[model samples]
Target: MVSIRSVHGSAQLLLDVTGGVTDIVEKMHRTIAREVNPLNRLRDMTGETPVAKQGHTYRIIQSTTSLLKQGLHRSLDGLSAQEEWELSPQSLKITAALNGVCGDHLEASGNPLAISMHLRNSRGEKLQPGSTSLSTMIPDASPRIAVLVHGLCLSHEYWKGHNEGNLGTELQSAHGFTPLYLNYNTGRHISRNGRELSQQLQRLIETWPVEVEELTLIGHSMGGLVIRSACWYAGELDLPWTSRLKNAVYLGSPHHGAALAKAGHLLTSVMRQFRYASPFALVRHTSAGIKDLRHGNLLDDDWAGVDQDDFHPDYRKPVPLHEGTRHYFIAAAIGKQVWDLPSTMLGDLLVRLDSARGQHSDDLKKLSICAEDCRVFEKLNHLDLLDNKVVHEQILGWLA
Candidate 1:
């Protein structure tokens, strides 16, 4: 069902978008006007002269937009009487995509569209730790637990493909491990999710129906970063769940950083230099989560006080793999072979080969994953790593 909050959130987002576009158009007009008029241009360039005045038409448009926004808000408040309505699957997908883009804004505005982190069953039902309902949900719980985390903008449902077999089911049938899925808002900072995941895992372990003897973590893309971040926080907080963790598998994870995110940051930075282009840059404000992917930020300290849009060198603190856990990394490339240019330049079409393998030129930044523990698959894209039989087999092999 679609909550009333979603409706209110959507309305607010539309207003914000239209308002931003209007501002952009007005700014562009003003910039053009200043350029065509030498006197106004000189005034803008020099502090001694007064700034150019805005056009009367632009002022009228701004006032009209404000009035419309206010009216919309008043109208939406009336609909609050109806708490919820049917929400389609297509709408869910759109909401997830929106969260990936501007989740921080939605969260800050208290929009119900923002997703919260939770543990879900294979059926996509929420699982609460330290509750009898957990045991009721999974009557046949096993001693060994395998926690699977999906990537950005994805839910636990991503793991269930049309294929005959999935990694979770295969693990259950072969290794006697019970599989659980972690569903979360991919637009939040990795560190924040990580900290929460750590606490959740602790509660799950403490409340498990059966004693958990071994724990395995598997993550794809940004999910892997969250797992790493969680492990870091677990150590700092001395969480007992860490003791049960034995294996960690990273599938197409950008341990160093994602190439596409870096490129986006660069483009946004360049666009901000021009007044005409600057407004366009503001059209799509990326979330703090996406910004963290620029350098695989796993700690709050990485971006606590820094301006994300400004060009800054990689100053992220190095976080090595856990001491007692066996770490495995899987990297994918679009090329037919590992030596191909595409494989080296565009690993999986999103992450770079070196970054996926956690191989950095700087010794301090490197994840130091053993060569034997790392595997590279050619001719596969990023999402392909999720359901491909070969990839599943490789993960199973690593866990074995």
Candidate 2:
């Protein structure tokens, strides 16, 4: 259920968006007003006066909008003090997408819309790691555990869609491995989420009702990158959960980088070079998570001091697969056959073939995955990797 807190957060976000659009529109109007006059345009072109001074009319409009927004904000605050309300499934989906786009900003601004990292059951109930109630939450807990992580703009409930829920049931029935789902804000940096996940997993293992003999991690798309990041952090911190980890599976994961994210970065960078286009670029407010996807960044050092808006080459440090654990990679293509050009160039429509396979032009950055350990399914797009029965069967076969 959506709470009163979320309602207020949504209202706040709407006001912020309205304010931003008003500012942009004002700038655009000013630019147009200046350019319409030849003398002003000439001055702008010569850099003598790049921006025209704000007119009295523009100031009055901005002031009026600001006042109106402030009034709305106060009203929303009052509404927020009311009893909690239930959030519908549709609202939850929208909130997840919003988080993926600007989750870092939401968190920084203390917006209640920001999703905190947590483990959840299929019913979407939060499961506190190390809590005594964990056994009650998962009564059929097993010695072998498989934790499923979803991709960007998604919640733990994603696994329960399109018959994919059977993956968990079958895993338990076939292998005596209990399944758990990880729910988190996908807009945060992968390294940050990874660090938190490492700690969470440790607490889970320490508090598990049964003695854990094996742990398997399965992730799709960005979730795979998060899992890899968590593994790296876990090793660095010497977390005990790392000892129980036996297998890590990556399905349609961009180990090197995603193609679409790089394209977006390039597009925005190019736009920032021109004055009129710069406003549009500013409108693209991508999160740190989206920026990290440009080159599969999984460390703080990769982006700490760099300006994301400026064009920069890939500078991510290499993160290797966890030692003492078997790794598997699954890739998909939209084409009907592996030999098809589309299959080779545009695997899964979002991730490229080589990237999903952890292939890199530079040897130092390549993942040392075995040829037999990687599988590519044709005629499958990115999201299909999550729901397809073939993908699930392949996962089971590898675990078996």
Tell me, by lDDT, which candidate is best.
1
Tens digits of lDDT, candidate 2, 1-400: 4477786687767766776777777778766768677688677655565354454555676677668657756766666656564456678778889989989988986677888898876566789988889989988778999999988888776677575545766678778888888988999999999999999999999998899999999999999999999998887898879989999999899988888988898899898887687777863587888888889988878789988778888888888888899999999999999889999888898999899999999888899999878999999899888878988889889999
Candidate with the greatest TM-score versus the true structure:
2
Clashes of each: 0, 3
Off by over 4 Å in 1: 1-3, 41-90, 162-164, 282-284
Q: What is the Cα-based lDDT of residue 356 in candidate 1?
A: 94
Count backbone overlaps in model 1. 0
Q: What is the lDDT of candidate 1?
A: 0.85
- Indicate the residue-level lDDT of 343 in model 2: 94
Instruction: State residue 283's C-alpha deviation in candidate 2, in Å.
Output: 6.5
| TM, every model | 0.89, 0.90
Q: Give the per-residue lDDT digits (tens) of candidate 1, residues 330-358.
A: 99999999998989888899999999999
